[model samples]
Target: MNTKQSRIRRSRKTRAKIAAVKAIRLSINRTNSHIYAQIISADGGTVMTSVSSNDKEMRAQLPNGGNVGAATVVGKRLAEKAKGLGIEKVAFEAAREGGLVF
Candidate 1:
């Protein structure tokens, strides 16, 4: 298969592993111009908390949220929100063609 298809294959395996663990998940998504993160329940049915560069508060602090710095900011913000929502730890999930990160 080609590179894109190979990546998707890898990601599907990763997601299947995550699903098997049946733990809360910290899902992250990064695009060319923004980063987003969310804390989902063990069954992945509930969103406990979420944060993104698109948020008004984060947007005001960042001129643009496309780089690693923006990812870090979104990660920290999401962590805080999750903590406030009583979430202390989680597994990580990613898209079918992506990888997980802290």
Candidate 2:
């Protein structure tokens, strides 16, 4: 499989495991030009909160929005938004399935 397909396969497996627990999920999608994150309900119909470099606030801080710094900034913003949405905890998915801890 190609790189993108392989990544999707990995992501599906991770999402399946997360779905098993049925907890609120904070999934991240990092693209070459931007980073996006969302807090999804356990059933996946609703998105409690979301943020990205494309957002107005983030757009100012991360004008380029395509670097590790931008990704980290998006992560922090999403977490803060989730907290405001009364989501104190979440299962974070890297979208890349990195070796880094959750």
Candidate 3:
């Protein structure tokens, strides 16, 4: 199988396992120009909080959204939001091919 398909398959399996656990999901999506993160409810029906490098505040601070520095900022913001919502645990979900480094 090709790389893209393999990555998708891996991600699907990971998500399935996470669903079985019924834990809050910390999902990360990355693009060439931005990085996005969201914390989903335990039932996976609602997004409790989200942060992105493309956000207005982030964009104002960083000229480029697709960089390690931007990723750090996004991660910090996501953590702060999650803490405010009292989310202490989560199952991370990210594509295998280009997952978040931290």
Candidate 4:
């Protein structure tokens, strides 16, 4: 009915679609002051890897974590972590309302 409700409905449908695929997911969340990325297991019970602009290391490197540059940094960090864990591929799940269901 309202915008927030519509966004929630869209996100719910997206989550259902993701679950049906049974594949690892790379989810991204961007807020006003931070960016976060996560790798989730197929069943969504496990978080394989995660990185955020709020991390201590990232915080030091990025004085301002609200911009696109900060988001890119978070994304790259997440990718590196995933690679180290041998996660070569995943389904991209961009949150309609800014977070994954899990």
State model 3's lDDT.
0.82
Each candidate: RMSD: 5.0, 4.1, 4.5, 5.2
Residue-level lDDT of model 3, residues 1-102, one tens digit each, is: 999999999989998988998988888888999999898888999999999999999999988898888888888788777778777677874332222322
Candidate 4 C-alpha lDDT tens digits along 1-102: 999999999888887888898988877788899888888999999999999999999999998998988987787777778778877777764432222222
Clashes of each: 0, 0, 0, 0
lDDT of 4: 0.80
TM-score attained by model 2: 0.80
Error of 3 at 29 (Å): 0.7
lDDT per residue as tens, model 2, 1-102: 999999889989988998999988877777899988887899988988888899888898886897988887777776666666767767764343222234
Specify the highest-lDDT model's number.
3
Whole-model Cα lDDT of every candidate shown, in order: 0.76, 0.77, 0.82, 0.80
CA lDDT, candidate 3, residue 58: 93
Off by more than 4 A, model 1: 93-102
User: Highest TM-score, which number?
Assistant: 3
For model 4, the superposed segments whose C-alpha errors exceed 4 Å read 93-102
* TM per prediction: 0.84, 0.80, 0.88, 0.86
Task: Report the lDDT tens digits of candidate 1 across residue range 11-100.
Answer: 889777878988787777889999988878888788878889999999999988989888877877776676677676677543321223
Model 2 poorest 10 in a row by lDDT = 93-102
Ranking by TM-score: 3, 4, 1, 2
TM-score of the candidate numbered 1?
A: 0.84
